[model samples]
Target: MEYVLVLYIEQALKKGVVQTMEMGLAEMGRVLRQRVLLIVLVTLLAVGLAGAGSFLVLEPEYEATTTLLVQSKQTEKGIAYNDLLTDQKLVTTYGEIFQSRMIAEAVIERLGLDLTEQELLENVRVRSSSESLLTAVTVTDHDPKQAVTIANAMAAVFMENLGRIMQVDNVSILDTAKLTSDVLEPVRPKPYLNMAVALVLGAMAGAGLALLLAFLNNTVQTEAEAEQLLQLPALGAIPFFEQKGSSGYRVVVRQDPRSAVAEAFRTLRTNIQYDEAGKHVKVLIVTSTLAGEGKSMVLANLAVTMAQAGKRVLLIDGDLRKPTLHHVFHLGGQIGLTEVLCEGVAPEEVILPSAAGPDVIPAGAIPANPSELLGSPKLRGLLSDLRIRYDLVLIDSPPLLPVTDGQVLSTLCDGVLFVVRSGEVARDQLQQAKGLLERVGAQVIGAVLNGKQRKRSEPAYSYYAAPEGDPHD
Candidate 1:
């Protein structure tokens, strides 16, 4: 039993290792797939740079080769196997002697070449074929004529010295050193091969860098990230929309009702209506961690969408410090929220109708103390009164981190819809924003991930398609 249990444990360990390896491979594939464009662009640039450097930076070297046949001197008896074996052995020895300092010095003196023995030997190479008694000596130099001259002189000097040094005089020249007209093109520094290697290296470097950046980036980028970081459900993910020609203050849902941007708001409307605490969430305040997060834009568009669905929606600009509803709605911001709060103006007087959709009440004027005004008792009473008249009251408040206006308004509202700009708010900042709302006893119903751009490779959603009736896969 003990032996069987140990065997089982070994199997389990092997299975676990395999699973871990599979997981690692999957992760690598994901990283490479997502950053393929960056890798390709970097690889192309590297290949161009390497090819250009090979041509412009590296020194050119020309080569000249001399082949020789090694044999025994003519004998009365026919050449024997032993003689062939001995000649083959001497071929290797002669190869070494071809590059020796003695032969290099002789060749330099005989050819009047201006080079030291070491430098001359460094430029020369000799190789002996294993299957034959053939030795080839090659010389490389910047000048093609000099390389040929050195190679031929080295071979001649080796033949002359062989008889004196080893008493063997059977060396025969098979081919003299020669070069073609195209000797200017060097054999080393192959540009095409260098570029190919550079491309692969650059691709690897780019992919590694992309993976590192993705791992280090701690910003909220997707709906999943927003929900995971903030501990709240993702209410909606709004796609980024580019403003085209003839740009004016108009809600995208009203101007281009068939656009994806308009569909996103409508989806947001359905989500809000079906949320766990949504039935009682009539007064919803829209705010984000910081300014320029598109919370105000989302609020305005959502208000327009809800109104188009025949709901009585009241769009109020609660950001008194820096009001933009007037600009968005193309209405006068002279008399609105401020007039109603300080002067006790009638709600109907400040609440004006928009040509596109919804009734908008712009922040009248910039207040010196926005937090104080929002935290007043009358503001809460005003919201309560508006809730009774309108089916839904959507307030576009200031960002939570910059001011206390949104937090104070959160206390009065039924629910808060936190908006996060994808890739804009860091994880730590989003966490802090959520903590602040929770500390104030605010009911954060859900979060909206705004300005998310869809990748080009993703398939398009059929907005006009009919729903399928099938329930099973």
Candidate 2:
């Protein structure tokens, strides 16, 4: 049993870590997909602009090649120049004689060129063919005429310098320098290649950055968030149920079963069980850090679910400033929590049946001092009275911040269940909400994640699996 427990705990912990990383990747994929069209368009535009610019804006330079034959001065040893460098030893003297400043300057002076020795040298190239006694001399320039003139001059000077310095006719120009009849231009700053590579790199960088941001965002973004960021059990999820009622856009949980909205509430009930809470969970308060988080809807649906389980459940719209139970139940706000509190009306008298099966009490008339109303001894006495008559009471109160209504009412319940919508409830909001609940000393029973999607990596609960027959193998 101990081993099993340890293994379970380890699995749960690993799942939490993996879930966080996967969520980050999932968010990255979503972002990439959303901007895929833009990425492609940008890539095409970049490559197109680069290719066009390379072809039109850049002028093509011409190349004039002159070939020279390298023969060995070591005919005495019957060793050929071809047996140098890659063969046995490099003819260091010949190589230096060709690349020297003396030969380069002599060529420049004889040609009456305006280029510096270094600049002129850049245009001249000496190349040796593989395992051969032949060398090729090449000069490239923007002007075709200058290219050919410079090539021929360089060859004459190199040969003269070799004869004068080394006293040998080892280097001979095989082909005199000449113009290419098929005069062509060069391709550099390859815009198409550069732009294509840049665009691709940019896309990869963007995706990688998005993934990093997602991973660093430790706040809960969805049901996957609850399991990953907090490593906590998700009590449930309740969706926004919309239907045409006597009032505009209210939930008909009984009439519209199997809807995505309905499934949310049922899922919430299942998650509640995941917390290992006592089966007799009652007197729950639903609240968030800020207003407009669908806390009331969650409470209403939770109450309905409890009622469906044959429990006498009462839903109280504790948000005295802004009520919703009366509107959802179509009670016209005639009699509700405000009326019962102010006039001392009985709970049974103000109780209204909901289309979803919960008995509800609306906020009634807006209270000038909601904080005082929630803190009053009468509210506590009323809760004490209602607790005996009903199996569960779900109080839908205002947000935790901007008022003390929720914190005050939470004091009258067993625990407060926070409702956070995916991408809607930010990390700071949850932290502040938790801080407030802690300040008020309210028991924060696990959270109910709202509008969360299941992840591919997360294992789905098998609570509602279909009945099946055994198959013979």
TM-score per prediction, in order, is 0.79, 0.65
The pairs that clash in candidate 1 are none
For candidate 2, write residues 333-386 as lDDT tens digits: 777788787888877787877666778888878878888888888988888888
lDDT of each: 0.84, 0.69
**Which ten-residue region of model 1 has the weakest summed lDDT?**
14-23
Off by over 4 Å in 2: 1-203, 222-232, 237-256, 271-278, 326-331, 343-349, 426-432, 456-473
The candidate that wins on TM-score is 1
**Candidate 2 local distance difference test against the native:** 0.69
Error of 2 at 442 (Å): 2.4
The Cα error of candidate 2 at residue 382, in Å, is: 1.4
**What is the per-residue lDDT of model 1 for residues 50-111, given as tens digits with 9 covering 90 to 100?**
98889998777889988999987767897888898899888888988887889988987888
Candidate 1 positional error at 318, Å: 2.1
lDDT for position 440 in model 2 = 72
